[model samples]
Target: MLALFKSLPDDGSYNVGDKLIGESAAEFIDDITDERVVSYYDVDELLEDIDLINESKALLIAAFGIRSSIWRPKLADAIVDGSIGVPVVPLASAWSDFPGDYEQLTSENYPQYDRSVVQFYQYVAKHAPAVSSRDYYTQKALEGLDISSRMVGDCAWYDLESLGEKMCKPEKIDKLVVTDPHQSQYFDQAESLMSELGGMFPDAEKLFCTHGDPSQSPKRQELASNANKYGFEKKDVSGDVSNISFYSDCDLHVGYRVHGHVGFLRKRRPSVLLCEDGRGLGFTETLGGCGFPAFTRRVPEASSTPKKILQTFPEGTIHQLQRKYLGGDRVSHPTTPARDDVVDQVTDFIHQELTTGWHRYEMIPAVIDETYEREMKPFIREISNI
Candidate 1:
């Protein structure tokens, strides 16, 4: 078994947080299989080495975040030509129509254009026996492109049940706020929000935490400065592994970043997500009914006060969500390593496809024709009519 993990940029300027997905995926694979070789490569590098990939018995694509469609055409071509040599399995990967609409395929730009989107779906549908989606929105997005996907939530959620039970719920808690500047509209308000949160919990330690990317360090420093001004401190976590420790030390977590909320939840700590986009809202909606509460970033007026935001969901809601989403007994006691059925399902698919010698030779042409008809034909027809 060969796992193809996503590689960071060659410039060495990528964030450590970006590696979290790949790392977790590798670890999960390691836990399940003993005969596995893990390799990391950028999209271009992977495309260049199609021959090397074809030598492998099975290929696993470890994608965690919203995948860009830039490499879709080439990847699909490689698969259709049997250059990959084996069945390509997408594990815990997701494609979102966020920041754009999937239906209105013509107007979008290169990385998210209609044909590219269709190609990605076509590749998955024809090549991959089963695709694991991170959330409902992603599953629907795949379905929109005539692809079927299973909603397994994020892979990070797999081990959370055990971790949650191991953590102690605090009566009086210190608050940790994870901030980022990507959401420019809410960036400036972070300081004020921290200040107000600090005042509300005067005796409790309010810490400003960030993903520790150097590019975002300046903004983190500014947030830290604001926190210091309001008697709050800054905590710098070195990597994704250390985030668990940082989150465990805090009582409550409020953050704009999805992983920030996830890190705290893994530690069995209460967390609130500052929803800024479809991804954020999807994460919230997936976990909200269970225990996690989400506050909209754009609607600052609605969740004006820290107290109001914190109190939006009841404590029982947190426990319930943790139980359902994370999967464990209601009691705070840990269970015997709750089975990761999703991992099992994926591994089974990989084994079955490889053993059955699934070929895309015949399906490739049909997939291409369908994609052209569904995606490209509409635009071509409109132009011709004009």
Candidate 2:
């Protein structure tokens, strides 16, 4: 939301609509800190009510869940049917799962179970004036579909501009915050890493915070208990902005949540993102630092090769594969459907981060800054035209 405002001209005005399914009214109030937002409406209200559409110059869909099965088709239909007359734009959009290879998608090679995924992107490519992807991976994935897009770093990175003064690499771990892994299967690895970190900075005040509510996820609730066992004080930062603000005050973070790592980095603080999925890997690859794969060593020997695994279980979703092999729980909520299971590379990056401090790798932040500029340039230019 902040990124959209930051991209605009000083006098530019816009209304904000949120499409997040489970988000509550109170949460929205807490999350939206900007006064410049002219009005707020539920995504349904924004889509159904033509009055809101008439008042808008463009409809910009902002941030994650851009590749969702539920909403993508609805948005695509609205644009195609002329219900939405204004230019449609998607800013910092990303695939929930990384597209492993780029080729004409088909039943044999298409990674996603839903064929509509590519169709949705194709529709936006034809109808929308501009589309901005969150990472190089997402850009490459879209390119395979012959859809041109600008590779804008995630909108979260733009929060750095507002937080530049406060962002810094701490010399000592005076305070620490950790966001744990979402799955029970990864808990042992997460705990081992946390134990090592705790030993390294015994005196640092530590707190465990969740990106989502623990009450909703059985695994997350259990993870919170493990954090407390490690002497971490459990802190509930329920709001989106509040979560980032909490991390900004912390000296360092080592966690499983992608946004937690992003929150810390935007504040110029050091963080280690335990890459359990493509989102973490994508962010790490884009910034050129501060992430490690928690489950690299856990993949069975027989299906270790990424290509072999994909070929053997072409239709097997992330959830299905994880349950069969990794002892992951089957949950009611829809997870990010992915084709790739392998964590690209396992390295000593985490060790170096915890031992030497993240600032030593000066090139990482420089790369992040460079990417921000390179990606945002095209996005700004395209959005201005809209």
Best by lDDT: 2
Judged by whole-model lDDT over C-alpha atoms, candidate 2 comes out at: 0.55
Off by over 4 Å in 2: 1-41, 64-73, 98-110, 160-167, 297-312, 315-360
**Which digits, one per residue and each the tens of the lDDT, describe model 2 over residues 1-386?**
21121121111111011212112222222233321222233444556665566455556565534442535445567777888777767766665542222221223454453666667667777877788787766666566567788877776665534422433656667898777665555666666655666776678898887655566556767777777677687765543453445566788777777767776675577777777655677777777656665543222334345644554543336455655765445332122221133222222444455566554555655555666556565565555444
Model 2, residue 63: C-alpha shift (Å):
2.0
What are the per-residue Cα lDDT tens digits for candidate 1 across 38-145?
566566678777677666555666553344433445555676777777767665555543232222222333233357646755765586655666666666656555
TM-score per prediction, in order, is: 0.63, 0.74
Candidate 1: what lDDT? 0.49
* Cα RMSD, each candidate: 18.0, 7.8
Pairs in steric clash, model 2: 167-267
Residue 106 accuracy (lDDT) in model 2: 28
lDDT of every predicted structure (CA atoms)? 0.49, 0.55
